[model samples]
Target: MKLKVIGIIAILLVVVGASCQSDDQIEFKRYYSGGSLVYQQHCQNCHGDKGQGLSALIPPLTDSIYLKNNKRKLACFIKNGLKGKITVAGRSFDDQMQPDDIAPLEIAKVLTYVTNSFGNNMGTVTLQQVQDDLNNCQ
Candidate 1:
């Protein structure tokens, strides 16, 4: 009976732990999972499946510093598109990234994915943040 009780307690602990994710964690997971689909559909073509980018043409998403520094501008870049030259991962890319015209929520989701995946950890890019950034696009 002692072994049975121990097993029951263990199962309860496991179930409780599994369901203990915080609200922010839940939000992040939702954004991350949705972003994964968005990335595969919209971004994977040019950025590559692993975000490694094309050789010397497109910029890789592996650069965490670039992502953090350009966090605010990313929404603009995505909504309005990007052109001209920019250095990423110690290399120059002058390729043009055409506008996606996706919604603000999708932008938030994709940004959250990119900034968290591929060696980055910038945390959730909330929809409100994306909307604010979009409003200030240059």
Candidate 2:
């Protein structure tokens, strides 16, 4: 009876763990797809569909050096556009990030899209996270 109970418990744990894992995957997928649509609507033209950027006006998110270093700065900059010249991966972008005119949810969606895209592998940026950060913006 003891062995049977232990085996059943182990199986239950495995099943529970797998279910939780799948839920996370589904969440990520939702964020990814939503992000893609938001990007297409707000960003793709200047940044390129692949995030390769265009000339000196926009910076590519695919550049690992820039993405890693500027993740937080990028989020804040998205909230409030940066002016003058800003360099990424030794290249400069002189244009401003259009004020993320969308609702907080849309802004969060697009940020998640950029973070997950362009070969950058950051976790999803939740709407709550964006909301919290935006509350502190200047």
Candidate 3:
């Protein structure tokens, strides 16, 4: 009877633990989910649904060699936007992505989604990180 009671208590603990989530986790979840919509609306046009750019016109986000190499400066790149010539996947794109195309919150969401999607799994970009990037934009 004691063994059965312990097992039941363990199960209850598991259930309760599963239900409990920290506030940061909830916010991250919200950011990640909202970022998907922002990407579809704002970015799907140039970047494509799967992040495959239009043949040298835009850069693909699906398998970002750039992101892989330049993770630190990525948020700034997003906030301040990109110009000049960039090479990705052995192809070159010479275009300017407008700065502040989306609001800062949406930028965080979009970056989080992109980093965690399309053959990339870097990590999440917090609102604080985005704000910091904005401060240090180039």
User: Global CA lDDT of candidate 2, please?
Assistant: 0.78
Worst 10 residues of 3 by lDDT: 70-79
Clash list (residue pairs), candidate 1: none
Stretches > 4 Å off in candidate 2: 1-20
Instruction: Give candidate 3 misplaced runs (Cα > 4 Å).
Output: 1-17, 20-25
Task: Report every candidate's CA lDDT.
Answer: 0.95, 0.78, 0.83
The C-alpha local distance difference test score for the whole of candidate 3 amounts to: 0.83
lDDT of 3 by residue, 9-123 (tens): 9999999997798877777788889999998988889889998878878889976677878766777776677898878888778899876566778888998899888888866
TM for candidate 1 is: 0.96
- The pairs that clash in candidate 3 are none
Q: By TM-score, highest first, what's the ranking?
A: 1, 3, 2
Best by TM-score: 1
How many clashes does each candidate structure show, in the order listed?
0, 0, 0
The CA lDDT at 20 in model 2 is 79
Q: Per-residue alpha-carbon lDDT of model 2 for 85-110, expressed as tens digits?
A: 87776897787777665678877778
